[model samples]
Target: MKNIIIAIAFFFLSYTNAQDKKIYALEFYSWVGANDNISYEMASIIFDSNLDSNDYYCNNKEYNALIRVKYSEKGVEKIFDYNAYVNILYLDNQTEIQNKNGAFYTMIIDGYAPAKLIKGNGSYNPDNFVVSGIVTKNTPRILNAYHLDDAEFLQQNIKNASVKPEYINTTDEGRAKIKKFFSSTDEMYRLLMLYIANFD
Candidate 1:
């Protein structure tokens, strides 16, 4: 009995050792711009190819980019491997994924993922963890999006809170009141963009 148990354990260990998992590096880039003007986007990911079906990582789709990196940064010398998952969104150009700049549709990567099977629950989930918002062309020096830190946000909110709250409206009367200040029509665009008070 003891010998049989030892043999089984050894076999399990051997099988586990045989399964070699490869961690591939992926460079997810996109065109970071609004309408006409556009720029490049960069964000790296050391993916542990553990998923059973990871065909998406390979150069199987248009978004799957086989990037041959030549430059080196910090210590992680750019892994000249197949990188992709850039143009996930098919907004305008469906035929073309990307041209000289970037991709057609940028995947909205946020913190969310699909969970394990919930037995009876069929709908399951469609949320995953992903933070690619600031994955712009440049680093902190020149961030693509305008982001306010907690400290800065608190400071501004506190300062504004001290003063009597002035709520602006977007209706005709509100626009008329705002226009009476002898201001430009461009300011009307800012009517909807408002800053709320700090929640208790």
Candidate 2:
């Protein structure tokens, strides 16, 4: 019958659409001692298509995507009553989800409110501080390990630190020198001390 044919076509269309979606779990954290401790789940974002491009945008300048906020109240995981679009950024060409344990992406929100999701009354706000985090496909969740305020300072120090040519490239020798320098540097040590001392 004609009705049966239309139903089959609709079913395939819906299935195809669903298959094109991707989910990312976002975690928030603050620095504790020498390590970045896991704070909580900030949100679960769904992308309608493959994130293959190095850059993507919602409008002309805004990188928009759908998000579901997940949080905890009194040791219980609570899904917040908000689902909306948020502006995300991949700062530069070097930024990619495949990078290990780096602040490859950022979510721009207004100010620092530990319990608030996004900006307004559970809506998206573009006037907030930029919070950076790592992304991975191994799980639909993202862990925000570094508070941008503290992390930015440390990152700046890393950029300005003096290093030999052997420590500046992607070669094995370069990687070894980088590891050794960080292990012996007072700047990194001082940053870690301050991070633990000033954690909220």
Candidate 3:
């Protein structure tokens, strides 16, 4: 029994090491709409040459926080890896929130699979966790999308919570009022986009 246990542990460790080296997200320099914008979208798993099915970190689609990344020529070299890209998402998303205080705006929400599940040999559970309100900003401004830390709350109130946004720009105070009324979710940004796309 002891030898068997030791062998299993060794195998698990070796497998994890191998998985850590793999590039899991598919990045693209493609164009969307007519903005001449270059973007990168990541998936939990890159479908084997076929692009047929995704091997998600979590089976639940909502938990996956992968978003298309946009880069200008000036910022292209800066986005060389996941760390830089993710940091940009955080900073840009916050900036959008701060800047849009006095304008008519829309907000989108979305989620991301927890970091643990993104591991090389990690297991997934559907009900594990989620973040909503991934995207939010004034329409013309079109702030970046992102996953926040409290999406699980929205899952409970999803029926009423997933409503289309109204662009109201009274003032910074007004934007704060709007944000305060809605419970921010990790998936806010993506959900907002879905709400707009479906309703519009």
Q: Which candidate is the best by lDDT?
A: 2
Candidate 3 lDDT, 39-104, residue by residue in tens: 322222121222333532112222122332222343432111111122112223335546444332
Quote each prediction's TM-score: 0.20, 0.28, 0.19
Q: Write the per-residue lDDT of candidate 2 for residues 1-200, one digit (tens) a residue.
A: 99999988986775565445433322222222223232323322323334354433222233333333333444654433233444566535553444443435665532322333422244222112344455454222233422233444466542211111111223343334323222333222233233223322
- Using lDDT as the measure, name the better of candidate 2 and candidate 3: 2
Error of 3 at 2 (Å): 4.1
Estimate the TM-score for candidate 2: 0.28
What is the C-alpha local distance difference test score of each model? 0.29, 0.35, 0.30
Off by over 4 Å in 3: 1-5, 8-143, 155-200
Clashes of 1: 10
Q: CA lDDT of 78 in candidate 3?
A: 16
Q: Could you tell me the lDDT of residue 158 within candidate 1?
A: 23
Q: How would the candidate models be sorted by TM-score, starting from the highest?
A: 2, 1, 3
